[model samples]
Structure formats: C-alpha cells, structure tokens
Target: MKRLLFIIALFVVPAFALEIQNLRVVPKNIDAGNVTRIMFKLSGPAKLSINVKGLNGASVTSLISNVLYPAGQFSIPWKTPKKIESGYYIPVITAVDQISGESVTKQIETRTAKMISLPFTTSDLPGGNKEISYSIDKAALVSIRVGINNGPMYKIISNWELTQPGAYSVKWDGWDGDHVIKVDQLANYLIDIKYIPVEIDALYVTNPKNISKKTIVPASEILRQINAFVPKYSVAVSNKKIASNSKNNESINLDINVDDNTLEELGDIPYEYVLYIDGKRYGEIENTTSPYNWEISTKNLSKGSHVFTLMICTSIEQINTRSFKVTL
Candidate 1:
C-alpha cells in the first residue's frame, strides 16, 4: 500500500485597499484539499478580482474576477491547491475604480503543505534499534509508536525530529523507557505516526479551519503553539486494538470485507467530485469520466471536523454524497 501525508497553507490580511479594507482569509490555515473563506469590507462600489498566485507571480486560481460589488462587507471563499507539492503562494486582491478603470492591488504571502515519504514501514521489527530511514522537505516533528502482536502500540520512540532535507535511520528498541520490548513475544507488529504538520501558511495557524463557534483563541496563542503535535492529525491503520498499559490484553486481528452486492454497486459512473469541510466548499473535480476513480485524503483535518464528498452523476442525474466525521 502507498502512504500519503497531509498538509495545509498559511493566509493573512492583505495590504490596504482604498475601497476595500481588512481583506483576510477565514480559518487562515487551510488544509490541502480544503477551502478558506476570504472577507473584506468595501468603502464604496467597486470592481474586484480576488486571485491566488503562485511563486512565479502568475495567477493560479481566480476566486473572484472582475466582479462588481456595492459598498458593504462580503466574504469570498478560496480553495487551496489540492496537491501537497504546490509550494508557497500569495493571495492578491485588486480593486478597479468603477468610473476610472484604474486599479489597486494588495497581496499577502502564505505557506502551503509539503509531502514527506518515510522509510519507516511495516517491516521494521522490535529488535535493537529497528533502523528506518526517512526524510522531509521542510522542518517537521515526527512521532512514531510501536505495537507488538496486534496489541496496543506504545509510543516507545519519538522526538527524533527533522527540519532539513536529508536521509537517515532512526533506531527504535520498542520500549517506552518504562517497558521492555521483545521481537518474539508477539504474533504481529504495528506502527503508528503522528507529526506536527508543516505550517504551510505561517509559523502558526492563528485561525484553524474548523474554529470553534463559541471559543475564542487569540492569534498569538495559536501562532506560539502551531508547531505542537495534534493527536487528531495522527494516522494509524490497524486490524487490532492498540494495546493499553494494562495487563492481560488479548490480541485479535480484524478483517474488513465487502459483500458481492456491495462490490457490484461499487462500479464507477460518470460524475463530478466536490469536497467540503464543515459546510464550506473547497475543492471540485469536474467531469470525472468513466472508471470514476478519484481520491481525496483528509489526513490534514482536525478532530471533530466533518468531510463531505458529493459525487454527482451527469448522465442520469444521480447524486451520491458521503459525510465523514473525524472522531480523533
């Protein structure tokens, strides 16, 4: 199986606008494949074009272009790039004087998610330092835990962090310093990882994409703690329940299978894929032709956020929508 990592980007309030002021992206730290909302207030009627540009100073995506609006506050939703490889970006908002056709531009720099391919895998065993190689494109905190015989995995080793690009092996003896581990004591082994995702937008995401409606967290606090690890972002797929520190826990492997009826219904039809998180629209793939196989990894989502996938069949007008709630 192929492994994938999740990420996001930073956003900020744009430079001053004569007719427009306080141009900012809501949930400033937008995850890969998720949407961020941009808001601003107008002093008078104006024509505006809100576009996100790549590093080459070229327009990547235009959220709003040449649209006229009355003097008032408004929000425009902007989608981040779907892929992690898209590096840093800038959001530029321009206003044209309705009567003169002259324009003013305001821009702000932001970060984007990066992907990492790790050498740590299912093959790493619990003998001595189970040597595993890994590398990252940017500074990141990587957390690794070990499990034995389909039982609870212990966070035996972590904090072997990386901030630069290089290849190296991190040895793990499979002990939490409080416990000892042996290779032959179990029937199967499991490993899990949780890394502080690279801040694609800023050093800290003052505003999380799924911000609490009632809770008010200051920007400074979010920035100071942005690099800290969040467990809701942890990734682990296993057939057995993670063993706890308690004694006498039995090990069992769980298998997942689909019925023939379900398999038959799984065939693809022509459709479009729309991704939304917490009731906000983010990414869309138009005309996903036959074989209708497309994928979006929400590994970057915070705990308690809801991911909605809408697959609309164009031929017969059938809509299949799935909503996944992240429980942690």
Candidate 2:
C-alpha cells in the first residue's frame, strides 16, 4: 500500500508543474489610434483564472470568466487608455491553474501613442482677386473662420468647407453685406482662416492685370507683307495698343510717316499700327493719310519701362516687332 501511494504522489507532482506555452500578443506594437489583443496557451488540463496588471499598478480583471480546458489556451482583449501619457507600459498576465494549484505569468511592454503636427496656412488667389485657398498636410477635420480686424465673427464664405487636406481652393466674390467691392478698394481687403497644425509652404494674394493701352488699326495692301512674318503674329498686330488705361497716365499718341517709295506697294490701304504692353492689347492706328497721328491718355501705367509691341498688317498678311525699353 505504501509503495502504491508513492507512485500516485509522483504522478500528481508532475501534473502540478504545468507551465505557460505559446504566449503571443496579437499586435506587438499598438499605434496611437488603435487597439491591442493578447493570447496564450498553457500545458495541463485545468480550470484557469487570468489577471492583468499595468506597469503603474493599475489592474484590469480578465474579461473572460474561469474557463475549463484540457490545456489552458486563452485569449483576452483590453482597451488602451485614450489619453495615454507618453511612456512604456508593461502588462503582466497571470494564469492560475485550478486542478494543480500552479500559476504562470507573462509580461509584455506596450508603447504609448505619439503627438502629431501639421503645417497649414491661408492666402488670396492671384490678381489680388477675392478668391482664397487653404493648404495643409493630411486629410482631417478642419475648422475655418474669417472676420475683419476686431470685427464680428462670420463663417468663411461657405462655412468650413472640407478641403482635400493638402492644397485646396476657396473663392470670395467681392462683396460685404450690400456693398459691392470697388476695383480700387480690393487691395485693402483682409482674409483669415485657421486650421489644425500643418506645414504651410506659401500664401499669395493676386491683383488685377494692369493693362496699359488699347487701340484699332486698318488692314492695308503693303501691310500684307508684314503679316506674312508669322501665322499668329497677325493677330498680335490686328489688335494694337489695347491697355487698361488705368496703369498708364500718359497720353496715347500716334505718328505715321511713310516713304513715297513704299506708298505705291502699300496701295490705297494704309499700314495698321497696333500696340500692347504686358500682354494687354492697346488700340490701333491706320496710316491712311501721310503723317497720321492719334493721342489718348493712360490711367494705370507707373513711371517705368513697359513692354511694347508694334504690328503692321493688311487684310491678307501682317508683320510685328516687339520693344521692351518703352518708358511710361
């Protein structure tokens, strides 16, 4: 009888030595915006209990109740704290085996979420126009507001429009209440938009195209030779000296002097003169009569050198030339 009891004791002692096996955390690292899961298996047939302790001594009870299994294979999930202080957290999982009174523990370290920064800014569209756009780094919830300096707050032209998180565009037609914005008053306008942190590379406000001249010229026979220079060049001379008249305060004057030798080839039709500065078309003049002359004052031109182009054309052909040093 004593020998039989010794054999049973040996078997029982070995069963009590059961250990944890195949322990794994579903996701090794948890990002700031995500959840984590952990799982593990044990060796003996027994009822098991689990307890998890955080590094800071905060303990979370096992979501699963005492579970019966031949071999203790278990899984548990825990929600990470939302506002996690930046630091490492160690999780201790302890499993108690009911049958053999054996306990096994495992530990895992979890990293906290990180802070994010974004670059962003706001600016006006080109031509000092009323339109505006916002640029940001990533797509996310955005809040934008605009107001005159120290004035009452108002929604951006269309409330906070969800922009494509990167480069985005918005436009504001020149209007405040019942007042329409005068072209001259557009410069003093101010716009403000705010958004989450993002890197803003640049912002720009554009002004209207400052035209310097505008005029019309007649198609002539000799002028046809000039029109043959280039295909599109004809159109360049067709519309001469068309400018805004606001940028140039100078008088629009024209003089035409043709040599008698070239007059016959020029025929009854006179060479038409067209001028433009800075891509704007100025008016034109026809050299129908000898020493033809015309003059008008400019409005927007500042005292400086502006681009000037002269096109001489007839109905069939046209010739054009450009000079850059024309002073206002």
Candidate 3:
C-alpha cells in the first residue's frame, strides 16, 4: 500500500507583477540639434529611472531619476547634445515594483544619424581621367548624376546604389552616358552626388548576454525616411565681374560665388569648382575661399554667343550648378 502513495507540487504566478511593454524611441535617427522621444508602457505601479548609455556601458545622458508612476504609458524627450559622438546609444529603464519589490531593467538602442565627417578626395588619371572617391561611416544608398550646370541630367553613374561602409572610388571618363560627347562640351561637367542612410531597426536588449549581438544592427532593414534627411544647396556667380559681351580678342574676368547662407552653414567644409565654356573644359579648382575668379580670353575662340557653366560641390558632395550666357 505504501508504494501507491503519490506526491503533488503547485506553482503560483503573481497577479500584480510589474512589466515594461512597448519600449521604443520615436524618430530613431536624429542630428545633434534635434529632439527624440523615448516612450514605453508600464503594466503596474513602479518606481522608474531612465538614462542613455553607450555600448561600452558608459552613461551618455540621464533623463529621469527614481520617479513614481501609476501603471500606464509615459514619454520622455531627449535633446541630442552637440558634443555627443555620432554612433549607437541605448536608453536604459530601471523599474522597481511597489508591491512586490521586484526589479527589472530594459534597454532600447538608438543611433545618431547626423552626417559626421566627409573627407572627400579626387585623383587624376592619365588621358584626362579622374578617380572620384569618398568615405562614409554607415551603409547607404548613393546616387551620382552627371549633367550641365542648371541643365538636365545626362548620365547616372549610380542610381540609389547600395554601398557598404568604407572608402569607394568611381572612374570618370568625362563623357556622357553613351560616350557620344564629353560632359565638358555640353556644359560644366556637374557631378551631383547624394547619400541617404538605410534605416536601422531599434534593438531591444533586455539581457546582458545578447547585448553584443544586438548592438551591431543588421544592414538588411527596409529603407525609411528617404526624403527626411536630404540636404539642399543653391549656387550663384557674382555679377560684379560677369560681362554680357566681350570682343573676340578680349579677356573677361568671371567671378564665381556660392550662396552666402549655404557657405556659412557649411563652415570649414572644402568646396570644389569646375568651369566650362561652350564645348570645352576651362578650369577646375578646390578651395575654401568663396567668389573665385577665372579669366577667360576670347582670342582663340569663335566669335559668337557662348555658354558658361559653373559647377560647385562641397566636401560632402552637395552640388549646385549655374549657367551664364555671353556674346563675343
């Protein structure tokens, strides 16, 4: 009869347990001057503290400190600091259940999507060839268009091409898409380059063991915010030295200038200029100084109406094209 005896065990679950839900960072990507919202929901009453931490487990910024709240939803706005490094950051939330004295923590990672640094450089090759190069911090869809300044795009070097992080070089033969004519001949050879970063999913790292794996965001996420972060530029030439008419054997000075507001916003960023006369390359220069001057002589040119195209590009590859017409 003793062999027939049985034993039973029972497990209980807490009815008022505290839990954090729907943790997220609104506008997951932002610049140093913008504000992003940190939002989450609470299942029960708890004492909460929120702060941002880097992947190296260092505190970046503190948002809240041991505040009591009823079970509901809450939001906190954090303004990115100018001194903050552009990279991945995590928002950590610590909660202590008021009834059960239980503690739980959650971390949702975010990224600073600002255009940090662009060290653009170019290399000249034989036979009037060029190697245009630049480096990027993150993966992006890059586009490079070629055309005359203030004219239609005649060639597409890259149309929203997916590129990885690193330096890349592109060869330019100075010709249109079909190689029918040199780009300089049509107008100022304008290389319009733009970059839009791929969207990265916010990682929710609740456990310490998974922190490393999740911190490195996968590059396969779908693209979002395509038009949100694109920068615009406007270019112009000074009329002080621009002449509407010139004799066939006379020399004329053309003063080129970019918008003052745009130059001021892009402080210390280097700029490159390429000038072209009707069907010919005139000159190309790189400098930080604005209102560059170019002296053109009509001594050897055919006496008639001519088109002058000027292309302006920043280190980050923001391009603006302007055209000037004159009769000789």
Candidate 4:
C-alpha cells in the first residue's frame, strides 16, 4: 500500500510554482490634484487578480477584478480618484497558481494630495491715516478693484495681470483719477486678487473708523494671512517656541512662532527681530521682518536682571512688530 501511494503522489506532482516578485505604486508621493498609478510584478505561470480599496475598505473607483495573464512577467495599472482628500490609501493584489493551487496577496499604500488657500487682511496705512495700501507678492498674479459695500460704482486700480509666477506687488496710491480721495470719505471698497496656486475671494473692506476701538490689528495677523496665500505645493508652516539667545551668563529665553503665510502674500521679506529690555526695545531687533520666526541668542548680554523685546513684521506694505520681555 505504501509503494502504491508513493507512486500516485509522484505522478500527481505539480508542474510549476508561482511567486510575487514585487508590488509598488509608481509615484510614492501623491498630491491633492494628481493621480497615482499602481504596478505589480509576478513570477511563474499563474492567474492574477488585483483589488484596490480605500482606508474605509470601500473599493476605489475603476479597480474591478484581477487581470488574467499567461505567466512569466506582467504588470497592471490603477488610477487614484481626484475626489479623495489628503490621506493614505491601500490596495490589495492577489494571485492564484493554477498548477499548485497556491495563492498570494500584497497590499500597497498611496497618499492623497494637499490643498492650500490664500490669506486676507484689512488695516490702516499708518498714523490714523485714511490712506490704505493693498500689497501682495509681485510673483502672485494680483488685481485690485474697489467698490462700495452696497454701491455699484467700482474702480480697478490694478487689472488682473501676471507679471511673474510666484510674487506680485501693487499700490493703491489712495487716489481716484485726478482727485485725491480721502481715506475716510471713500466707500467701503472690496479688494480681490489671486495669489499663484491659490484664490482669495469675498475679502470685506471697511473704513478705518468702522473698526472697534479695542480691536487692534497685530502684525502677526498679516503674516498669517500672507501664508494662507502661498501655494500648498511648496512648503509647510507651523508655530513653535524657540530659544531667542542662550550664551555666557546672560541669556534670554522667549517664544518665537514662524510660518509661511507672510511670504505668500508679501513676497520675499527680510528677516527682522526686535530686542526689548524690561518690556522696552534694548537695541531694537532689526531686519526681523520676514514670515519666518526669530530665535536669537543674548549670551553676550550683560549679566543681572534684564528684560528682552522681540518684534516681527508681517508685510512689506506695512511694518508690524510684536514685543515680548523676559528676565535673566
């Protein structure tokens, strides 16, 4: 009986083996507006099948069934849907060996794209001056149109034009035709512009007098607005606490927050940081005006109790600063 069983097993032995050599998504890094392709490679003579599913286990659109090929090497392509938001997606590839009745499966990961928007701002020009200046990057395609809140009358100061790709700049000059319009007398005019890669709309305008007395526009607010206009494809922005100056016996520790919003709206800005002693400008942090954060060291500062001041400007149109003091 043993000899007969051995003979039967030898005669029924499988003729081929199947294996999965590799499985990968063509573009590992995918953005918000692009599509990702998935490819698979196999070895041996086997029937293949593939299925792509999202994070929720719901199958991605267009991926239906496994494809059948005559063995050797084969590849399959799958496209990611555009409606999918920014996140991770997984796809499954399964293959079955016809001769050995064996099967294998693989899971692939894909990422979704990121979407970025623009920032808006409203502020007085300076010295309680009625004249208001609207400024944006020279690279960003920007156009300024002024109209009353409820009136049909409108004026186009800068028509929508692309002088460059990333940064753009335009000045209102606070005038209408030959007549120099007083800032307070002008109707609330709405301004609209498109900063490259992002669109900004419905930004309201108000006379400087309309603002609440207690409400003050912080320089950082403009920075945040500028960052919102930057294209999402370029860089990321975040706020964090950093050490200003740490050296020798005299050191000042302060919180510094930085982001990209300022660069997107204001164009290239010079770095500036203000130093304060006991809530006063020690030497006035100069050149700390860009969108990035400032963390300078005061190790060379004289020893004993001392306060430090730090200031940051948001836009080139207006110089805004914030101050913080610390004792050492």
Pick the TM-score winner.
3
Q: By how many angstroms RMSD does model 4 differ from the true structure? A: 17.5
lDDT of 1 by residue, 1-328 (tens): 1222222223333344456677666775555677777777777667888887643455678888899888789887765645533234456888887755668777653332332324454335644556655555553545455544333333435532323334445676644332333432445755655443344342112234342212121212222333321211111122132222232222111122223343344344333445444445556666543323334444555555342323232342222233333332
Candidate numbers, best lDDT first, in rank order: 3, 1, 2, 4
| Tens digit of per-residue lDDT, candidate 2, span 177-269 | 212222224333345554322221111111123211111112121123232311122211212443334424466554444445445545555
TM-score of 4: 0.28
Global local distance difference test of model 4 = 0.43
TM-score of each: 0.30, 0.26, 0.40, 0.28
Please write out the lDDT profile of model 4 over residues 195-255, one tens digit for every residue. Answer: 3322211111122333221111222321233433221111222213434346542443454
The lDDT values for all models are 0.46, 0.44, 0.64, 0.43
* Model 3 Cα lDDT, one tens digit per residue, 1-328: 4434422222344477688988988877666557788889999999999988764467888888999989999888888776565555578899999888899898763233433333456677999987878877675556677786765444567645545567788898877654545775553656777665544344222222222211322221223222232334556666557863545448777777777887875566567887667645777787646766666777766778776766676554435555556677
Report, for all candidates in order, the number of backbone clashes. Answer: 9, 53, 1, 40
Model 1: how far residue 62 lies from native, Å: 1.4
Candidate order by TM-score, highest to lowest?
3, 1, 4, 2
- Scored against the true structure, residue 201 in model 4 reaches a CA lDDT of 17
Could you tell me how far off, in angstroms, the CA of residue 246 lies in candidate 2 after the best superposition? 94
